[model samples]
Target chain A: MHEWTIADNLVRLVGEAARKEGLTEVSEVYVKVGVLRQVIPETLKTAFSHLIGEIEFAGAELKIEKIPLAVKCRDCGSKKAGDDLAFTCGRCGGIDLEILAGDELYLDYLEGKGNGE
Target chain B: MKIAIKEDILKEEDRIGAENRREFLARGVAAFNLIGSPGSGKTSLIEAAYRELGGELAIGVIEGDLASDKDTVRLRNLGLPALQINTGRGCHLSPLMIKKALPEIDLAALDILIIENVGNLVCPVSFDLGETAKIGLISVAEGDDKPTKYPLLFREAEVVVLNKIDLVPHSDFDREAFYSGLRAINPAIGVIEISCRTGEGVEEWGSWLRERVSSPAGR
Candidate 1:
């Protein structure tokens, strides 16, 4: 599954962040996943746990924040957060819409014990 | 202690993709990533393009499949410079794969490079392979609801190639519904309907390729 691929990237990013922060043990990792990405939270969590099990951040809590799809209509200039995949403007019935968010996949922050703590 | 690290998970991949873009620009090669579902006529469209524009443009291909080099062999049989990447269990082709394949091809000798991604809609759309444009291919047999079902692919693709148009009459494929779905996701996406088997719209597809190769913008 693509979850494995995403988890691999997440591990690398987390490792790099840990190194920069001098974290000997990471306790929690916060990530933002967009709804448009179609990523299953449960699957991603499983993948993340599987990948981090043997690392220094083995027991780190993977916290995921799902971001809803937000778009701005070019015709009516209306901003809307949509749950469905219609992708149409809610107010103006326009198809020309600019995506404002919800396509993101990123690590927001992390909490951990650093060196000499 | 808390460490603030707001970073895109695919930052490294994007960085490599940017490097690939620069390399393509330096070589003056218009590269296009062709993505579609299995049995959506991706290989056939490549063959059709080879037949139509092979003589006019120096076209090279990079075929990405799970475990076979059948597509690479097919293109090689036609005497096209082709390379194949077997992703094994990977569902999509990553920028790293593209980076490795780049050295195998003589970039300076080609005007166009077409990377045929693994036959997957969801995973491949998220990964950029440093191509000039991403082409989403859907056939009439796949139903008109594809754009709505897989919005990201349609939203990200520069153009959507509707292949197997000859089967439109045989199947109950609604063209208006398809266009409406595409419009909702990507209003400005260029659409070219073609039947590779019958060569119905190969000329238009070839012209689109030619324009992309000739234009400095490579839109």
Candidate 2:
């Protein structure tokens, strides 16, 4: 699954962050995934669990936040947010809509024990 | 202790993609990434374009597949400069791969570079390979509802190529539903129906490529 690729990136990013912040052990990792990405959380979690073992932060917990899809209609200047993938404007029924959000895939933060702790 | 990273996951890939884009722009080469399902005729479409525009336009190809270099051999046999990237377990092609492959091709001598992405619709749609445009391919055998089923590809693709028009008479593929579905996601998306098997509608696709090559601004 492509989730493996995403998980690989997550592990690398979290590992880098842990090293940069002088973190000996990463306990929590927060990630934001948009609906447009179509990443299944359970699969990504499984993938991370399998891959994170190779790194220093083997037991890091991944917390994923799903962002809903939002769009702005150019014709009628209406904005709509939905969980579905329909790209049509709900208000004006226009097909010319600008995507406002829901394409995000990023690491939000990392919580862990510092070198002294 | 919380460290706010706030970094995009694809930041590395995007960085390389931007670099690749700059290189293409500098060389005045129009690069197109072709994405579709396993049997959507992406390679065939490239072949058709080569047959039509190869004499006048200097064309090259970067073929991506899960394991084999079959597509590369096919293109090379036709006297086109071709390179293959076996992604192995990876589902899509990354800009880093393109960056590595670019050195092999003489960009100054080529007008168009067609990249045949690994045959998966979902993963490839998200990865940017620094192409001038992404051409989405869907065949009649895959059903007309594919556009709605995979809206992101339809929305991101510059033009949707409807392959296997030769099978339309035998299959239950509704052209009307396909057009409407594409419109719902991308109102201004261009569509070209072609059957690489029968050589139907390929000239139009060739013409589209020629126009983009001549006028990179139009891409």
Best by TM-score: 2
lDDT (10s digit) by residue, model 2, range B1-219: 989999998888788888998899999999999999999998999999999999899999999999988888989998989999999889999898999999999999999999999999898888778899999999999999998888889988999899999999999999999998888878889999999999999999999999887876435
lDDT of 1 by residue, B1-219 (tens): 889898999888889988898899999999899999999999898998899998888999999999988888988999988999999999899999999989989999999999999998889988878899999999999999999989989988888999999998899999999998898777778999999999999999998888878863445
- Candidate 2, TM-score vs. the true structure? 0.96
Write the residue-wise lDDT of candidate 1 on A1-117 in tens digits: 677888889988898789877899999999999988878889889999999886778988899999999999889999988677667787978888888889889999999998799
Candidate 2 RMSD computed on C-alpha atoms after optimal superposition onto the true structure: 1.4
CAPRI class assigned to model 2: medium
Best by DockQ: 2
Task: Assign candidate 1 its CAPRI class.
Answer: medium
DockQ of the candidate models in sequence = 0.73, 0.76
